[model samples]
Target: MYGAITAVKDLALTVRQGEFLTILGPSGSGKTTALMLLAGFISPSEGDILIGGRSVAAVPSYRRDQGIVFQSYALFPHLTVRRNLEFPLEMRGIKASERANRVDRILKRVHLKDFGGRMPSQLSGGQQQRVALARALIADPPVLLLDEPLGALDRNLREQMQGEIKSLHKEFGITTVCVTHDQEEALTLSDRIVVMRGGVIEQVDTPEALYDRPATLFAANFLGEANLLEETGSDVQAERSRPFGMVAIIRPERLRISTRGAPRSPDADQRQSVIGMVTDTVYAGAQRKYHVQAGTRMLTVREHVASGQQVYSPGDQVRLEWLRSDVRFVTP
Candidate 1:
């Protein structure tokens, strides 16, 4: 019951009462389908979804106590923001006075108290999103399911909303599950990130663990940019091969650049250094990214350029060195 095309596969994930878990994957990776199953929008073809140690596979969609916010604002066009926020409570038969009190509290929490009388079309994109969030939070459900809720906002607004959502989560300690393809959003917002590939869970860990010691090549490359260097039999014989089997994963920031023609240190290990020519350079506000051609592989390195220091240009020959401890071994 996930996605447009259903492919039945077993997936097991557990969420604590107030944990902020993010389900991260590319499109068609079954992340949205997973969320849909938990929200009771779609039932699994097989297997059960449990809540509070009880199986909820048979629970009806309307009966499940879950709050959902989608990528689109999904607000009613004719209804004012106040009415939109009250719809969920109205469905639950809450008293008008109680609903109004809850709605006002949430409207202020989302910073849309003044915009409550305005229509969804009358507000900015960010403000509309805040109203949608208020609508979801009005019910105070135990589980909050968000499907790319910030995807519609611009870059600056998206960042601002991310912080707002994080602060709200901390304030209320509500259990949340967010699905997104954006890696940076997952890293910044999630207490634990669940990486998915080909409709299955690839790895689950903290942001630092996923970035620093990815369990697989897919995990390493998916979380961020990683340069994979193949090691031949001769390279293995030369002690350049990693322990995982076939390739070594090096993070861009872990690489160190040294001027060519310098004497090698007597204690330097040959496997930890490579001679390469800088083929391209891209200036990032805080750091510069250099594309270095080493043998048949191209490696990316990020270096911070001080205000007064000279910057490296394209085609500059340099030696790339990194400590063995910085190298992550991944299976081919």
Candidate 2:
């Protein structure tokens, strides 16, 4: 329990065979600690870790038969790419000829066949990341652990690496557990996401379910932008009643903005509308975000940028509407 503080208490998680699961949380949420415990880098005080139905809580990190990639890439600065990839095989007492063949095949698989003679310092950031991943998988470990694997890359490189990681995971069919605070990364790469808070699991579900129907207010806001309807000081209209101590929430993209008193959707009977003055408008490349002040609450609305679409500016009165069925009740 780390003296007086408990980091990741009563944690029980199961990762299916060949499934990609991500542990997502912000700082101080115990995601890293949980990963460490799984990796055998640290022992849990109260629970055992099972891999393939066998307890490994007392196993050392190196003997756990798992591959790990850290945020720093962890490639030896003085070693050539080929040597770095061969290190894992050598540690397993493999013959020199076989290690060379495995190294060549893996380097070619990662599209770095010609860069084997180069040192870590000579390669670009993306190239170094590839080397790290290749080294981890060269041993054919059944499970893989990634600790903020893309945190060191820039935006464009990170996106590229995400695609690469996804492709490799599909090809290898290895069970993987990733720890990251990046919401977009979790949503893009995970088959299921485990949301953590205060050293406990907040929710666990598929990415779509977690985003579409978060059970808690913390999860709703963490996954994406949420509009709290009750704070508008107006009655909220929904298809179902909200439970006690719960609030109604709608995603920003669910709200449609139009000119005041404009034509409504075909199913007008099932929709609700609200009028508000535009407080701010943001133009992202592919979409636009609008902040509107309706009564006492500021609501956000997002829309894709399309041709012939009406635009709203600050101080402009706009009508925001959404289907009553789109509203979801969540715990605060």
Candidate 3:
């Protein structure tokens, strides 16, 4: 409890074989603590951590057959690229010749074959990150632990590394558990995501399931941009269809925008529509976003950029429409 500061409580989860699992949460959410507990770096105050059906509560971090990559790419600055990769194998008492072969193969695999003679300080940020990943995978551990692996890279580099990491995971097929606060990164790389809040697991599910059908307000908001809406006053019961109050989640992308006074589509009768004024317009390269004021609530609507798509400007009146099924309910 850190002398009265409890980082994690009542948290439990399992990682399946040959799967990419991501632990997602904001700062101070115990995500890193959970990873440390699993890695045996920090022993659980009370409870057991099992691997292959055997509790490893007494196992030390060095004994655990897990590969770890940190945000800082913890490499020995004094060691060359090849030496850094060989450090793990050397610890396991592998012969020099065998270690050299393994390091050579891994360097080639990570496209750093020629840079083996260079030091970690001689490489770029992305290259250094690659070396760190290669070092982690060179040992061929059964489990790979990544703690904000891309938090150190720029936007373009982060995207590039995301693809590289995904490809490598496919090739290695090691059960992976990554920790990240970036929701998009989790959605991008994870087969399943574990959402945590205030030292507790909020939800665990596939990315699509978590985004499409969030069961809680925190889950709804954390995973993506959601318009939490609810009917109040007269017609609340009829429109909301819930005896108890709950918020309806509407994704910005799920909404459709049309100019005011336009004839509703044939399916409009079965869908929900609201009229609003275009308060603001945001132009992204591949898409456009509109902020519309409907009653007291401001709704966000997104439209993909297309050659013939109508672009709504600020101050223009518009109508937002979406299928009734798109409005999913979540507990407040």
Candidate 4:
């Protein structure tokens, strides 16, 4: 408790073998602290950390044999890419020939084969990121800890690197843990995600399950865009009009927007309908984001850009419908 300020509290988790696990949270959410604790950089106040059925709470960072990729890349300024990759091997006192082979293999694997001789300054941001990842994996550690490894890259580069990281995990089968505030990144790459807030684990589950059925209000809002609606003391189980009592989570993408007097009845009987007025509309290349005011609550809806699709304008009466099973319940 840093002088009575608890940075992390009541955090519990178990990572399976060769799984791509991501700890997703906002700033000061204790995500980084959890990674540090697993890496053996810091010991937890009252909990024991078990790795492969052995406790590693007392082990030092260097002795843990875990690979870590920092947000800043943490490569030596004066060292070339080759030497930087070689640092971990040199620290382990491996044979000179073995270190050379391992460095060459990883450099080639990360697609930085020819950039080894170049200084870190001579490389682009993406190249430097690849080098950092190679350095971390060159040692063949059992566990890999990535702390916002793609935060320094642009949007395009970040997306590209996400694919590469996932590919590497499949090839190496290394049990990986990544900490990031980016929701999309976590959703795209994680086999399972652990959501944190105020130093507590809010929820942990597969991305599909977590997004489709979030058990808590924090998770329902944090993972993506959500329309949280309050229930007015009615049993939602019996009435199709009433949402899941307490609070209902209607995802923007799950909502279907239809202009008044639409020709087609798409799944009419199975869907719950809400009458609202279009408040705003945002056009994008592949789809449109719409804001609808239904009963004093603003709800967002996303629809694909389809040929002959009806576009609703402000002040237009519209109906937003979704399958009865789509409205997930989020308890207070």
For each candidate, the alpha-carbon lDDT, in order, equals 0.84, 0.94, 0.89, 0.87
Q: Could you give candidate 4's per-residue lDDT for residues 114-146 as a string of tens digits?
A: 888999999988899899899989889999999
lDDT of 3 by residue, 286-325 (tens): 9898998887778888889999888898899888788877
Which regions in candidate 3 have their CA more than 4 angstroms from the true location? 231-243
TM-score of decoy 2: 0.98
Model 1 bad stretches (over 4 Å)? 1-8, 231-241, 244-246, 262-271
All candidates: TM-score:
0.92, 0.98, 0.95, 0.94
Give the Å shift of residue 257 in candidate 3: 0.8
Q: Rank order by lDDT, top first?
A: 2, 3, 4, 1
Using lDDT, give the best candidate's number.
2
After aligning candidate 2 to the native by TM-score, how far in Å is the CA of 44 from where it should be?
0.8
Per-residue lDDT tens digits for candidate 2, residues 1-332, read 78899998889888999999999999999999999998998898987888999999999999998999999999989899999999999999999999999999999999999999999999999999999999999999999999999999999999999999999999999999999999999999999999999999999999999999999989999999899997574699999888999999999999999988798889989999888999999999899999999888899999999999988999998888999999999999
How displaced is residue 249 in candidate 2, in Å? Answer: 0.3
What CA RMSD would you report for each candidate? 2.8, 1.0, 2.0, 2.4
Please give, for residues 123-157, the per-residue lDDT of candidate 1 as tens digits: 99999888888887889888889999999999999
Superposition error at 66 for model 2 (Å): 0.9
What is the Cα-based lDDT of residue 27 in candidate 1? 82
Q: Which residue pairs clash within candidate 2?
A: none
Stretches of candidate 4 off by over 4 Å are 231-245, 264-266
Q: Candidate 3: global Cα-lDDT? A: 0.89
